[model samples]
Target: MTETYDIILRNGRVMDPETGLDRVCDVAISAHKIARVGHFEGSAAREIDATGLIVAPGFLDLHAHGQSVAADRMQAFDGVTTTLELEVGALPVAGWYERQATLPRALNYGTAAAWIFARKVAFGAIELDADVHPIDQMGAGSEDMCWSTEAADSQQTDEIVSLVRQGLDEGAIGIGLPNGYAPGAGVKEMADICDLAFQYGTPTFTHIAYLSNIDPKSSVDSYVRLIGLAGATGAHMHICHLNSTSLMDIERVVELVSKAQEQNLPITTEAYPYGTGATVVSAGFFMEPDFVRRTGSNYSNIELIRNHHRFTGREDMRRAREASPTDLVMWHFLDVDANDEHRRLLDLSVTYPGGSIASDAMPWINEDGSIYEGLEWPLPDQLSAHPRSSGTFTRFLREHVRERRTMSLMDALAKCTILPGKVIESCAPQIAKKVRLQEGCDADIVVFDLETVTDRAEFNAMNRPSEGVRQLLVNGQFVIVDGELETGAAPGQPIRREMP
Candidate 1:
């Protein structure tokens, strides 16, 4: 007699991105393992009639900030089971783990060290009052993001580097180079850390330094430079938010990067599916006159609807400028009509090589225990811009891949799943395994109502629950069942991707 399985999903279209095969079949799971894959006729204690739903490996978000609970919440609706926080390695690893250990999320998590964050935390001695980057004994600062000054020039950088490696070594899937936001950080700082990331074979996701600075050293130039670094170091460089910065030039930039890749440069990129891009008011776009005018968005033209930290309204934004001139803010940038350069950009990458989807949503908790609020300042448009938090995956699926037919669904899912999974596994061997589903993989899976799903959590969409997550399971426990959140469960697990 065949042993009864724990759960069986019968009569569903199995959309396997891994196999690129779509079929009407039954899928069975027992002991947290994907028990059977083909016309599986097995009895189970619990059975779901997936007649028209799509059963694929839960989607993987290549880029995320790790703040919004909805980040996990949307997983149910978006078919995402594994989500990675590639946010410039902001939080300390141990503390990050400590907090995540308690958050009520419905998924698996992995992270790399934020070299820039560590640099700033360690930058206590650097006098921000001065403009010239603090010169070190080595002089040129960390060459090629190759290294950073000790200030003491001692073992501090070594320590940070070790931590960076340790995070990956400890199971972080990849490295984050929030390089764009940290101009003071030199190339050496990047190169040194990336050397280790390369050594581990983990991909380094970078925010090209020229992202917001679309002048002098424009975003395109920064991307070219990052591509060059990827080629020189033999490091895998994954550019984040390909649509954000001067990303309107993405087509040409993609061609350039692809050309580099023809010569075998380790470069790839991803974008969040939203017209408006967000960043701190202090971001390079704000500093540049052209970017501000082109986007037709300025500090005064924008409102501070959300202040997760000390920054508040326009007055607060102004004061915060005085307070932490380097502090970050999220802003919107997109146009309904393509400018001339944008047309050229599109022509270059009519196929738009290697751009994936990601949400750079940071955890929005304040000292007073609050998530970020939209800007309150009376600006031209009080509209806040962050559709990625809820709708990135769906919009991309529904709009471009499904509606506009920009790319096939298989190509789209590859960006979310196999790509990052393969990238992370390079360093974190545990991720590159057959056991991930062989009854022993950490149970981070999301089951969704593919037929009816919605992601309408815009800043103004009063009282919205995420759309269409039928059943979400993490660590063998259901977090969302019958399209509702299971408020009383500790199914969330922090997937540390390093070695013991």
Candidate 2:
């Protein structure tokens, strides 16, 4: 007698970080959940011959900023099944979620309530644009600049808190605090935000308040304040992109996070694999006169992503910053040396045993500041932007796991999948049912050839898709099959923290 399943993956090397299961096996799925994870006499409506492939939970990105169709396709080719804008989250969380729900995407999606946008709205800095993503709308013009440099008054603080609560009530996963971009947000304001997270039983995803490796208030000082807030309010805190933020001081920053965890503080951190970091020219870090000295990068090392024009001098940098404050600029912090410190630092973040990996992906905007729309797969050659947006996870597996052997494949897989799932599950319990290959888990899975997996996207030619991702599924629906995308599949569902 044979049982039936919606789909059966036969003879694949199944890997589950949660249960330490790593062996060649068969997995059966029914409806949209895993039904069995071992050999079984079963017939299926659809069967995948996943022989010689690594069958693991689909990858989840916690810091993706490109929340559009074009971005989704790029991520799908790289094997990402779910992506969330947790670093610089959306404003008016309901509107963001509603708009996304109406669209067809290649992967599951969600976002946090953006604290920076709330402050912008309260201060009347800039009117929120319905069409643009919240992070793109920020720091674009003179009015938006105030959201970063001007401190909020008491009334404004209250308004910000109210907006955050409204977002939570509307099912936001957590609170996104990109404090580094908004230097004017005072300690009280930040603490109040964390307090709100504590009150609502959610986490706060933060880009630390400072990025300087050294100064009056360095990354160390920033971690102290953030960790202190978590200790005081009992709010879970997630630090974003530690590699770029910590620079030469990554070891110290990691130590601080370790001590906090030792004291049982609910704190976690993530980092991208790249050495160079990108951000808007108008960010507060560029406002400082000694910014170059502090970050150890000069004008020559900075290049505009739109035109690939390198900044020649102080005046050129100033002119560019003033001319287009919102344009993306790349900082070559890791180019100073080649002794593998940058690689080592990145390895430390993924190998920390408690930290997760995030891409901090930026969108591929055209020269006229527009993103491509529609359900086209393998985006056209015209799309160009940060390589990390397309290749972070693939590069991590290729360079760290396969090439360097710094971490086992199973360990690295956990960093990208189950670890981030656990972090989100802390705030949204629904996520606990996702991001694993066990029975009763959501059938979001990836099948890939281990030996040939690698990233092809580079800074010069940025939008290239990866190689060796054979298939990808979201909620048991195939988004990519036989190394090609299944166009027009909108099976991606919203992962939210519905209020109890």
Candidate number achieving the greatest lDDT relative to the actual structure: 2
Q: What TM-score number comes out for model 1? A: 0.80
Which tens-of-lDDT digit does each residue in 191-244 have in candidate 1? 777788778777888877765433467767787778778877888887777766
lDDT of 1: 0.56
The per-model lDDT (C-alpha) reads 0.56, 0.83
User: What stretches of model 1 exceed 4 Å from their correct place?
Assistant: 67-70, 125-163, 212-215, 281-297, 307-317, 323-329, 337-354, 364-369, 372-385, 432-451
Query: How accurate locally is residue 277 in candidate 2, as Cα lDDT from 0 to 100?
Result: 82
Backbone clashes for every candidate come to 46, 0
